[model samples]
Target: MGAARAGNGSDGIATNLPEADDYCLTARDIRCVVLDIEGTTTPIPFVTDVLFPYARSNVRAYLVDTYRTRQTMDDVAFLRAQIDKDLADGVPSAVLVPPPSAPEEEVIDALVANVEAMIDADRKLPALKQLQGRIWRLGFDGGEIQGVVYDDVAEALARWHGTGTVRSYIYSSGSREAQRLIFGNTEAHGDLRRYLSAFFDTSVGGKREPRSYYEIWQTLGVDSPSQILFLTDVYQEATAARDAGFEVLISIRPGNAPLPEDHGFQTITSFAQISV
Candidate 1:
């Protein structure tokens, strides 16, 4: 199905769809490359199937076992931070939860329900991400979870970093720690963690927000945002990167990607399609 089938569709031309000829990188422009996990460098299921389920099955227990404990309060605080951050970033309140028309109790209930639902969806909801960070922390400590990155990731990282072609990093809604765990424990990758320079998560800013991309550039000591090529499967995020002045490429894995939209950036079917 084309993007039109998604219901919230846009004409392909309205978004910038680049031809292969338009893209040129002779392993010179990109001094640093930041990656988005699902749909980009790795499969969506690796995160949704492996990471999400690990966190979900453990969140309640982790909460119950730790409720009122320092960590629980910290998780709540992190979620609250995400909420306030979104509001400050101009994400409409309605998208998360419209202010209740009813009493205070109803509003509180709606808020909790909204957060929980986002959690269930493995969404990037601030609350869910905070909880994911916490759950993964526990899982990692207990040896119940090992982060799962893709087979291609290690080879790609080695090639990029070994040749001094570009520095590699990750940006995901998953906690920075979770991102590290996944990449660090790729079944064959060994500890590829040393190859990365930094990781950013929702705690920094929503992925769809241009400011987050700006922050990433700032962290990398790259004053020019356009100097970096950000690979992501999500068009909104790629839009955010391009809006922030970074180069953008959308990766479409099989059974992944929501049709194709330049979404104000370039699009690719795989990392192999990208020319460093």
Candidate 2:
């Protein structure tokens, strides 16, 4: 599938549906590119199938092994605070984290239970993502996990970086550390981090919220929102970026969730289609 004309007649939005031609970006004065990870640069299956499972299955051992370390203690404290709020707000599957004085096994068990639940629910809380990033760090360092990206990603990143005008960034729900770990350890590319200028996560704001894009635009220090191009696989995200005045493109990738029929956004199957 190529670019699908968005039905919504927003001013400056592309409305031409090209059957065979890829959506061209050369016409736009895009100075910065903000990319989404899951379902856009990386396959959804790599996250849902491999990454999540690795974190879920190894969380217990990780907690047990690192229990007394300062980092683990901080992680536990953060999760405890989050779970306390969740329980107060009546969030389902929110488990009680035992106190630090509790038996080590008991504390580890409670933390693991809550972590697994968060993983299953795919919660975007900073506590959860921070812990997951640390866990994945071990796996990546040990050569147990290798980051996976679309074949077109590394080349496009290189091309954009080579231009000296278009800067590339990643804005994902994944913590910035996790984003680095993924891009820094890819098998085929072998350290794509050099091409990325910076990373943004939930600390900025939720991806679907327009204000998040506004925050990113300000941080990028670009001439205008129109100077940035946001690529994502979800319609809501594309809409959010567009509302923030950034040009948007919806990525069409295998195993990605279906978009609404009337979701009026240009779509691209490969980053190679995008010209800086």
Candidate 3:
């Protein structure tokens, strides 16, 4: 997700849009709406500020507290594999995770180092994302964190769900669990998960890869890729979805990174702009 200014309850429409009124999903025969989280439905700062920091500060405690659990063991194994690959590739800041027989403190230290490096680099590896999701689940469940989304998101989701003609899905680099935690515990609308049909993560593929969008189309069970509309703040992701034959819209939320002048995709600043 790219950065832009926060929304201020206006229509939030972008100026000089290619075709002012051409953003209607109904006009394009769209049936599914796949949304991006950060910098799209939710503000980028919420993730960069509240979520990332929460995960970073609590990772060590989370690991230590859950150290002996089967899930943490599984997470460790997954991280070890990724870190091994990273080490072989001479990834900067890559550290060796000790064998499971090693002292627990030593293992946790190595894992924490590697996890911090991955988080600092904003790497979208599934292992890092999955672990972060588990950490965040604790924060969300403990009332230490509340998900933040654009003001218009809940109403738009409700409108689409009410129609029964459109399905809303989330596609993010964040893990599926993280996606659920945010939408399920939003500040504006508690339990927005009811509005969403499914969640997708990097397991399908990288967000920038066209094949990922192809896989999403197949999983959506739509008649054609054209029936799916994807919204994102990243130019590359929009291009990827468009390349895969899905209708694409670039979200112009506050704090979103600037798009290329020639990006050539239609843009929307609020979900209300989408007439589903």
Candidate 4:
């Protein structure tokens, strides 16, 4: 995750949540809507079942072939730093430490093994996400993978964007390039990227961090947090966006984690139910 930035609410007026039925931004005041990917826009299964396995199976070959590239080298360097930090913290793993002069194949094998372990554990480490995204790109371009989003998403995005009232954006842990690829090459929606104005990822800040939402608000050049509405399936993510002063709604998508019975946020099962 990127470093957090401190800021005030001076850019936009803050507002409290309205009545339950008034949660729709079209009924209230909103200028921009930020969305999460996995559960909010795309079905969780497409990610856990399709994307994860593909990355886990292809990491070795992808890394071996791409390691010399500047971007891949940067990701590897970040992974090495993470491994070093784990070692300093006394975590033990043969894959975590290898001599700098180790054979290229041996190093790649260890890295692949370690990365596969991280995927199994569902670690959100940026380096791992970067590598997986790169691998997925190859899969996407090879016709081996096709992105999936909920049924209501494509139409809602087009409708919302066509109105010229609310600009749409994506803020996921996936890299910006990966974000574009999914929206651009979706199986159901041909080139949905046209509906989106921008994309953001961990390069902003951790999704669950309040500062991240604020940074998004700032980055989008929006007037106030109240003018932005964020949608996510995770209650914690909703809480973070709410705390950051943006209006937030919990997306109750199929296969999404169940929201708590006492969850305070307003919830929606489809984008058709959302406005603005």
Q: Write out the backbone clash pairs for model 4.
A: 12-224
lDDT string, candidate 1, 1-276, tens digits = 122212231323233344323344454377788998877767677777776767656655665566557866666566656666666777544234333244544434444654545656556675676667777777666767665566566666776777675888888887787787777766655678888878878777999999988888888887588789888877778778889988877765654646454343455554555455
Residue clash pairs of candidate 2: 6-264
Better of 1 and 3 by TM-score: 3
What is the Cα-based lDDT of residue 218 in candidate 4? 89
- List TM-scores for all candidates, in order: 0.74, 0.92, 0.93, 0.89
Could you tell which candidate, 2 or 3, scores higher by TM-score?
3
Clash counts for all predictions = 0, 1, 11, 1
**Candidate 2's residue-wise lDDT over 1-276, tens digit each?**
454454422233334533324645567888899999998999898999999999999999899899899999899899999999999999889888778888999988888888999999998999999999999999999999999988899999999888888899999999999999999999788999999999999999999999999999999998899989999988899999999999988887776776777566767778888865
Of 1 and 4, the candidate ranking higher by TM-score: 4
lDDT of 3 at 69: 97
Off by over 4 Å in 1: 1-28, 80-115, 141-143, 260-264
What is the TM-score ranking, best to worst?
A: 3, 2, 4, 1
lDDT of 4 by residue, 1-276 (tens): 112222222223221222234256766688998999998899888889999999999998898888789998788888888777766877555266466588888878778878888888877878878888889999999999988877798988998888988899999988887888889889988889989999999989999999999899889887789899899988888999999999887776556665554466775667887765
**TM-score result, candidate 1:** 0.74
- Residues 30-114, candidate 3: write the lDDT tens digits: 9999999988999999998899889999999999999999999899999999999999999989998888999999999999999
lDDT agreement of model 4 with the native:
0.81
Residue 238 accuracy (lDDT) in model 4? 91
Q: Tell me the deviation in Å of residue 131 in model 4.
A: 1.0
> Residue 190 of model 3: what lDDT?
92
The weakest ten consecutive residues by lDDT in model 2 span 8-17
